[model samples]
Target: MRTGIRQTDVLIVGAGPTGLALGIDLARHGVDALVVERGGTLTPGSRGKGLQPRTMEVYEDLGVLDEILAAGGPYPVGMIWQDGRQAGEHRMFDPAEDGEEGSRFTGPWMVPQWRNQEILRARLEQLGGSLSFGREVTGIEQDADGVTAHFATGEPVRARYAVAADGGRSAVRRALNIGMTGETVDPDPLLVADVRIAGLERTWWHVFPPAGEGAGFLALCPLAGTEDFQLVAQFPDGTDLEPLLTLDGVRKVVADRTHLAAEAVTEVGWSSNFRPRAALADRFREGRVFLAGDAAHVHSPAGGQGLNTSVQDAYNLGWKLGAVLGGRAPESLLDTYEEERRPNAAAMLGLSTAIHRDEARRGAKTRQLGLNYRESSLSEETRPAPGEIRAGDRMPDLTVDGVRLFDRLRGPEWAVVELEDGVFLVRPDGYVGWAGDSTEGLEGYRARVGA
Candidate 1:
């Protein structure tokens, strides 16, 4: 019980993509935030390798898109193998036309999750934000003014608000006594690992279907910008999966399932096993503490929605937290964090589950471009009839007077754009907050949100 007082405007638990992204957002806004991670270092593994177009836009605003794009490449076509030979190509996502208008990004980019976390952590550090690793939060207590978080070691943290981005098994979330009700998307256990293997072409993702009855499927995806391939294997339901995390176990599984020899597996970087499931927290917020990312919603990785949704969760909450803490907006604005994000998270969870069961395809829905907060209390649609884009919808990227819409909405403040039809107020996260024929209610909206 070391007794020292460390104060920050916001305290974030977990240093994953969500916490790191939120730190970057808060740091740029001049908000004092401290990020604490239970682990000593960044979590390893290329578990979530798909970054949808919308997440790319968020990364661009956070000043890390260039690095992200440079570090990753477009997803390669899937190579279906038959009798240890290439059969045909399988497209994982819907194809996009060149030079699309609404988005600068065409489709999902492939970046290893560990590398993504490192990039975000670097950006947060560059912005003068602080992250404390090896500080597992044991308890959290919040009152009228602020919240205090207790850690396994070191002094407690006192902050105006606390965020749980600590993943599905969040200690903070459990401590808050919040319930998460969900269903198992698949009974089959999945083994995902990052490994270096020889004699495998990096040109395409290799798919190996189950050999016989009671067997499972295996897919080896070439992780961009690295020699590692993300290997995913599914076991029949009720099969014991505990032994698959070891290096020898993974090598054996690879040799047994694929055509490659066991010696081709040069190294195993990280490994884990899990049963796919979808769950959402009963509430995203409990008093001054809020849940973001996997702490709020758990999704199957089939559609690659988990990480993207988690990143967007931080994007949505970061500005609101900054605004409220800066005294620029009323505290009620914080309520919208849960209101707008929880429903969106729920939708993604269902999409992910559907994709897991092969009930849905990895198409436009997984890209997350169409997600909006139109029904949100924060959105004000004054138009009698909305056009292509409406209030609460994402502000599509377009050039106006030689300025990109995203460029105009890059900072921590809101911007009003005058299009052909009327005026639209774009939120800091690149969503249209209000739209009307004129700037009639714009002032009131601005004042209320402190935009």
Candidate 2:
């Protein structure tokens, strides 16, 4: 047990998208943050592949939108096949107008989960944030002042606060004894893999429905900016999956379901199998430690809400943590992280489950641009009767006084948005914090937010 007095303002567990994004946000704010990952390297495989329009805005704010756009492509139309022949084309999402309401991104963009994390890691490092791979946290102890994380092999970490972004089976979450209440969204298991195959065009997302009873569906989507295709296959509820996780097993699934030969699959990059489940932590925060990403909520992968929601969780908590740590705001501001994010996580969980059960469609809702915090405690709408845009609504990217709204809202400081109807105080996270016809109560809100 090597021991010394090493400390940071915040200690982030798990170098996934959530932790890395939070680290970047903290670094830019000049907060001392350290990120630790249990693994020796960044996690691989295209686990979450879709980035919604709202997330694109977040990436833009984080200064990685250009690389994200250059590294990925638009979702391809689904090509449905039947009896080894071309059947028809299937559109996965409902058609939405591009750049609606001044948003720069229209629909979902395809960037493999691995590549997404790589970009975020680079940005965090570029911002001077520190991250340590292979630092597996075994236990965590938090007092009234700070959190101390004991790892499996190395010196412990002491910080003013800590976050668990380590995934559904989080070690810190378990050490804290937080309960996860959820239901299985689907009984059948799903096998997802990244592979290289011949004779498959990259123009379409190839879909192969089950051939007969006892068979399951399969889909092969060409991953953008890579030579790999994300292969997904559904298995019968009780089928054994151990034999189906190998390269040969993947080839068998592809050849058995589609019109291709088993030999067409040339390489297998990564593979995994799991049953879809939706669960949420009993609470998002326990004392000085907070749960973000999959540590707080688990979602079925149907509507691509898991990753986006998780990333937003970091975004919501990052600014509050910064404000409180910097002594700009009262510590009470930290409570709003759970108050605002938990409910949204619950809603997205239901939406993902609905889409998985085919009870909902991939439409405007799936894009996540309409998500808001109208009911949050931070939202103060002073008007007796408000119009469509109310306090807590996301401020659009329209130009105000010849300056883009996002450009003005950039950085960790709150902005006084001068709109046509009224003046709105935009939170660093981009939501309208307060709105009034004049600056009458603006000072009070600013004081509360440490602005």
Best lDDT among the predictions, by candidate number: 2
- RMSD of model 1 against the true structure: 1.5
lDDT of 1: 0.92
For model 1, the superposed segments whose C-alpha errors exceed 4 Å read: 1-3, 99-101
lDDT of 1 by residue, 306-330 (tens): 9999999999999998888888999
For residues 221-329, write the lDDT of model 2, one tens digit per residue: 9999999999999998998888988989998998889989999999999999999999999999999999999999999999899999999999999999999999999
| RMSD for each of the candidates | 1.5, 1.4
